[model samples]
Target: MSSEKKNKMPLGGIINKGGTCEDYDTGGWRKFRPILDKEKCIDCLICWAMCPDSAIIVEDGKMVGFNLDHCKGCGICDVECPDKVKAIAMIDEKVAKKG
Candidate 1:
């Protein structure tokens, strides 16, 4: 690759900028979404911590819900939710919309 072409973009298209994905909706490719059962949630914020997309919506130091626009439906939050305290479930996007 030519030096000119090499510097054109960061490796793997990673940008040095912050909050890069927040400006654009990248969840269109997602196949699933996490549904939160607030009743079961203990305000532990484990989902928030494990979410790679930072899609867990938090307000006032409490987890509110998911930001689907950026969630990418990775299901990390659902998996991270303690098994003993499962408060999140990953659902297919189509089924999620129906219900």
Candidate 2:
């Protein structure tokens, strides 16, 4: 290969200064669950039961809140929900950081 051509090729395949890998922050490993629209909820306690962390809570005969601290953001609750429109969603921590 010519000198110019060799220069154009990466040296030792090492990443250059300008190159970047996807940045994944390990700082916030905590996961969160977003509760669904109240109008869409049918009082089915699927989310309350499916949460492995027991993050969901029922209060005063209604599904009230989710304990984000214990939640791992697993999609089980969102998937198992019987509502036509899924009531719960797992939000990505990284995306949350952008806002």
Candidate 3:
């Protein structure tokens, strides 16, 4: 198959450019947001890999936190994390961001 066909999304069509998602901040769109508990985290980077929006921030090959600016509160990271070690939790944005 051609390279383009091989790289095509299963849902079809180029939804957006790759690695440029951060340019558009979707923070206001989130109802719930993923909060990281650094104490409980193992830094396995699972959330980094599972984030569809590339919202997980990494530094020196370790997951430090999420870039809420582009995250849409999808919760894919929380769901993909191992059951026993729930380092990422989705919490109401209002409560989490309370002043």
Candidate 4:
């Protein structure tokens, strides 16, 4: 066999036309939405339809994900869940910072 080496491109070498990586650190701008407990969810679509940002996704017979980037922690989903136990809740930014 001939002695040869294959060169692999560096992962960061690829950048958008703006010369910035898509995965650049956001400096804690993102927020986390409280996940709903399906067993306690009661299949109420209140949170899904009431979300102002349309961040909640219901897919394939399951509540899939919340789009945190646009959520702004408006608490609409939490209040509208209609569960007496209040399964959905707003996790404040301060608490998120510590975690």
Question: Best-fitting candidate, measured by TM-score?
Answer: 1
TM-score (C-alpha) between model 4 and the true structure:
0.56
lDDT of 1 by residue, 1-99 (tens): 576666466779777889776799978878998899989988898888888888889999888998888889988888889889899998899998888
TM for every model, in the order presented, reads: 0.78, 0.58, 0.75, 0.56
- Give the Å shift of residue 49 in candidate 3: 0.8
For model 4, the local distance difference test gives 0.65
lDDT of 3 by residue, 1-99 (tens): 576577547465555657665577888899899988888888888888888888899999888898888899999999988888899899998998993
**Residues 25-68, model 2: lDDT tens digits:** 32244664465667777768888888776767788768876665
Q: Give lDDT: candidate 4, residue 61.
A: 56
**Superposition error at 66 for model 2 (Å):** 0.9
Give the candidate order by descending TM-score: 1, 3, 2, 4
lDDT of model 4 at position 64: 62
For candidate 4, lDDT tens digit of each residue in 43-95?
56678899876667788656666666556566788888885856676676677
Alpha-carbon shift of residue 19 in model 1 (angstroms): 2.8
Estimate the Cα RMSD of every predicted model relative to the unseen true structure.
4.9, 12.5, 9.3, 9.2
**Candidate 4, which segments miss by more than 4 Å at Cα?**
1-35
Q: Which regions in candidate 2 have their CA more than 4 angstroms from the true location?
A: 1-28, 97-99
lDDT of 3: 0.85
